[model samples]
Target: MTQPSQGVRRSYGVKAAPYGFLLPAAALFVLFFALPIGYAVWLSFHRIEVKGLGLGKGSRSEVWAGLENYTSALTDSELAHSALRILGYGAIVVPVMLGLALFFALLLDSERVRARSFARLAIFLPYAVPGVIAALLWGFLYLPDVSPFHYLLDALGLPQPDLMDGGPLYFSMANIAVWGGTGFNMIVIYTALRSLPNEVYEAAKLDGCSQLQIALRIKIPMVAPSLVLTFFFSIIATLQVFNEPTTLRPLTNGIPTTWSPLMKVYNDAFTGGNIYAASATAVVLALATFVLSFALLRLSNRRTTQGATR
Candidate 1:
């Protein structure tokens, strides 16, 4: 047998190189992300059945549940209530957090602003803190006894209402998410802003466009893609809200074990000892996230195409 020509070998190497480099990533993705998701999906349609005294080798067995688990999860009032709570929470969080992020990014990008570096770092510092730790820290500050707002109100002889109860609890939870998240989103938006061409600004300036007008008409529209990306992640994060409320639950009675849809899944899987139901709920949540994300992306793409055509 004779060896292949150098040209043939080089061509083969070129074709194989890309796949070789991608092999590790593809393997890891299958082993980690894909496998776990597939397992969860499988579990969603299965339940455990106990036979006889439930002590022998064949006593406990996995059985197909069909859509029973999905049906139960859909009709679950607690889950529905949790979903509503998260919707309200997201309503408060996504807008306020992204708005502040955009505002801060604009301010940081402004040539007129002083101390831009210091301000940017100061705003972004919270992103360095872990989500659990941030929730714990904010949980302390929300307590009436330790809260500065409560102290101020007390000192001024004003109403020092409970921040952990009723309507204020929503704001309390929203504040924790916003504080931890705004900085990261701001960095994303600011990076997008920084990537814009300086020529655009010069032209706007030549046209007598004010800073506000340039930002509103040029910067914001240009960075709309980044905004859409941030909004997509924010919605997913909001729907899967678990850490803050779970961390705060021990501190107050206002938060329940099923305070959010993710928390409800947690309760069902571990606390309630119903893995089938939990898996179904998780699958449902995943589907909802995908649907909403796709819808938002399509809407954004449509608008972007329209803007480009105009």
Candidate 2:
């Protein structure tokens, strides 16, 4: 028989093999995620201390600023306006995108719908297009001289509104997001719909249920998991609205450097040369994202449990 010491050694080896394999991933998480996060948090609490013409040895120092950065960030009216602008943008993008996705998914799932393959491909084509290119294409389309919309409006003697200006810019940008995102979300929902057992639908039909009744009762309920997942991701994406606006910046005068929160952070860091404040804003944004995500997950879990019990 093996000695107890040898047996213990062998057991330890067996248990440790998995951890040894996981070591690389753990190291990467520490180096890339944990380390940078810790650094950012440390920086957020401090600012540059400049002395005497801001040049010489010991001239630049990082002094503790406590909650000064947070206070300033909170009180900045520009940031407040950006937040409200994003809120309005999100209000439009989230519902309209998800609604169109859900509608397209349902239509695709229905047996009577024709040319689904072609329609699906056409809709999903935008996902392959780069965000910059997509924005540029739409940017030109929104312009008076270049747009077919302008020609049609002029022919009809109707007023042609600039899509990239003022209040309409929200809708314009939201449209880009919806067009690019809907097909992907639709596919996710449609896959869930397809996975449902046929017997459930057959039973509903036998009970004198109409198509709409069957979908509302069975299909939508069954696909709630996918819907929740989509909604969560959509929320995150909406909150990080940067690329579309940035791309459109060169083509239009309306989008300021501080159009979105992320954009604001970028401008502060690069243009304003204020890395300390940028770090603070970035940390705040990350915290907000985590809180929102946690809240969404909890709400989804509660709803799921209540639904399951019923």
Candidate 3:
């Protein structure tokens, strides 16, 4: 068979170079991601067989378990409860956090706002601190004894409710998430806001639009991409909430070992001495996070396109 002409051969050879460059990345992907995922899948579907007195090398064998692990995880009421708690927590955290972020961002963008530099830096400074440390600080503050709120209430002769227990614990936890998250989300949105052309706003002002109208109509819609970005990340962060609640565990008796899905996975993997189950739960959580994020992104993107068309 005749090979391609010289020009055609050179064109093919030039086109092939990019794939040749990508070969290393492909290899690393298989080595790191694909291999580990496949191994996890294998482990998720199998259990160790303990024989005799469970003391010998042959005492343990890898055996197939079908969907027993998955079914068990799905039916697990504790996991379900943890998931529901997180859902409620996210419902509170995401909207409030994003709303505050947008508000602060708009304030920062406002020309008449005083001390914008100081306020912006002060707000964003919390993002520099670790989540564990942030939770620890807030956990103390939420304690009635250590809280200034309680002190103020005491001076006014008011009762101090138990913040480290019951429904308040959810808000306390959500507060930590909001505090740590708000600054970063604000910066994302503020950066988007800063990129807006002055001419558009000037023209809007030339028309009959008030400052509030300009902000509500032009500024918010313009920064929809950043809002989408922060929303996506907030959902991921909310679902994987572990560190804050775990840190607060020392301060409160209310938080269980399985307070969050990640905490449950940690308990199963380490405390419960069931790495396989933990891995399975982790995989399931990860899959759920991905699916939810994907669905939300699709919905957001559709709405965004429809708004743009209008």
User: lDDT by residue for model 3 over 1-310, one digit each (tens)?
Assistant: 3456877889999999999999999999999999988887777887778999999888988799888788878888999999999999999999999999999999999989999989999999999999999999999988887989889999999988888888998998998989889999999999999999999999998998888999999999899999999999999999999999999999999999999999998998899987778778878998999999999999998998898799
Error in Å for residue 159 of model 1: 1.4
Off by more than 4 A, model 2: 1-14
Candidate 2 TM-score versus the reference: 0.91
Candidate 2, residues 252-289: lDDT per residue as tens digits?
89999999999999999999999889888988888888
Clashes of 2: 0
- Candidate 2's displacement at residue 39, Å, is 1.9
Clash count, predicted structure 1: 0
Worst 10 residues of 3 by lDDT: 1-10
Candidate 1: list runs displaced more than 4 Å.
1-7, 52-57
lDDT of 3: 0.91
TM-score of each: 0.95, 0.91, 0.89
- Which candidate wins on lDDT? 1
